[model samples]
Target: MSHVSRSAAVPPDDLSGPLTLDDLENRADKAYARHMETYTAVTVLHRVHMDHAVWNDTASDTLGLAREMVTAYRDVTRKEWYEAYIAWATAAGFEIPADMVNDGTDIPTGAADDPPDHPVY
Candidate 1:
């Protein structure tokens, strides 16, 4: 996995003046990349900890704690990035159509007449 780092400079939160959409998009993109990098690192640490259980338990526990800390950092970074994107989009007057729905599935609108094949439980 590729290494990701957060930018030293973040976009100012002051929305008192006009801001370009392109600039906002660029900031959001950078934030997203940083978040992904942290997330990948945390996942890798977790896998390593689980796979090397034969090693000293004390070392493994320390690594597990590190993974948990990084996971929390990744979650916060992701949320901040999402909020920035939404704020910029709203400031630019980008609106979602009333007819559109986001169900986190690839199924097209009005195309799935039956429920999913698998049970929720």
Candidate 2:
């Protein structure tokens, strides 16, 4: 596999404006999209590094972390990342209730082309 550096793909830390965790959370889809792009690049880089045995022939956390992150990326790729977030959060002991997010809103059947937006992403 070919590898590419992330310098060109990632936005500059100071690009457009100052960065904040909240800002990132607010742009979840955009952030996830960029993350997946850069992650693909970095994974290629790591595979190359492993091919060259740059890590001293010892297994490291990088591979596991990459797998976990990819799982997370797939979870967030859903149209309702925020809904999943709320569910996960509640299961994790947060106080968010489903009604607070879903609000009994009706979605037309067979509306795959227009999935409802996740309110809490």
Candidate 3:
């Protein structure tokens, strides 16, 4: 199992205190960056699992399950990231821009392309 430590990615201390528009904007940027970083990492890991499964017959089930988990986690992370941004914006008394919100209705759920017979490991 691979672990990614995020202990150093702590939020800025100014969030608990008086915040200017600039502070709010900076927070939003950091949140977005973190979300993107997670998304990219998950995507890479999922691809790795899928590729390994395709090439190695013995570990297909395990890798498939791992890929499925990564997919689900990616979806949840995407949703939670958006929610966190909205919460931060609300706390900062800033209006959430319409483009920033993705309710996931229009996005692919990542499971649609999975093979039907692969059992979870």
Candidate 4:
């Protein structure tokens, strides 16, 4: 909700030194927050703007393209946020495990607490 960037949180000004676990956690938290904001905004646009555009039948091609782009953006946002969350959790604990599906990949939904295959809509 505050100022967040698309990149990691600001690190120590001296780059010569290695970052501490706390530092890494902070960075990951910022990354997660940044992506979370983006994902939330994209979802709102899809639900409100795209939904309206479709119902009105306004520029079907354009709306379809916009929907495609937003979906891609949402997917990326979800991934990045989850990665950051994992990193932060790992830093806080010893090792934070990912939620894996039977396919050997992540649950493809959200952070550790998300239900498997939760619908984005």
lDDT of every model, 2 decimals: 0.57, 0.44, 0.53, 0.53
Misplaced by over 4 Å in model 3 are: 1-34, 46-54, 101-121
TM per prediction? 0.58, 0.26, 0.44, 0.50
Question: Residue by residue across 20-70, what tens digits does model 3's lDDT show?
Answer: 445545656775565455445556655666565345565666666766775
- Across residues 1-121, which tens digit of lDDT does each residue of candidate 4 receive? 2233324344443575655556666767776676555545545555665466336456566556766675676567666666656555544444444342224464355254333222365
Q: Per-residue alpha-carbon lDDT of model 1 for 1-121, expressed as tens digits? A: 1121222232456855445666666767787677667756765676676667488878878887887787678667766666556655554556733323335443122322223322333
lDDT of 1 at 83: 59
Candidate 1 local Cα displacement, residue 23, angstroms: 1.1
Error of 1 at 112 (Å): 20
Q: Which parts of model 2 are misplaced by more than 4 Å? A: 1-32, 35-42, 45-49, 54-59, 79-121
RMSD to native for every prediction? 11.7, 16.9, 11.7, 8.3
Candidate with maximal lDDT: 1
* Candidate 1, lDDT over the whole model: 0.57
**Candidate 1: where is the Cα deviation over 4 Å?**
1-12, 15-18, 50-53, 96-121
For model 3 the TM-score comes to 0.44
Q: How many residue pairs in model 2 have overlapping backbones? A: 0
Clashing pairs in 2: none
Q: What is the lDDT of residue 53 in candidate 4?
A: 36
> Which sections of candidate 4 miss by over 4 Å?
1-17, 43-58, 94-104, 107-121
Model 3, C-alpha of 112: deviation from truth (Å): 22
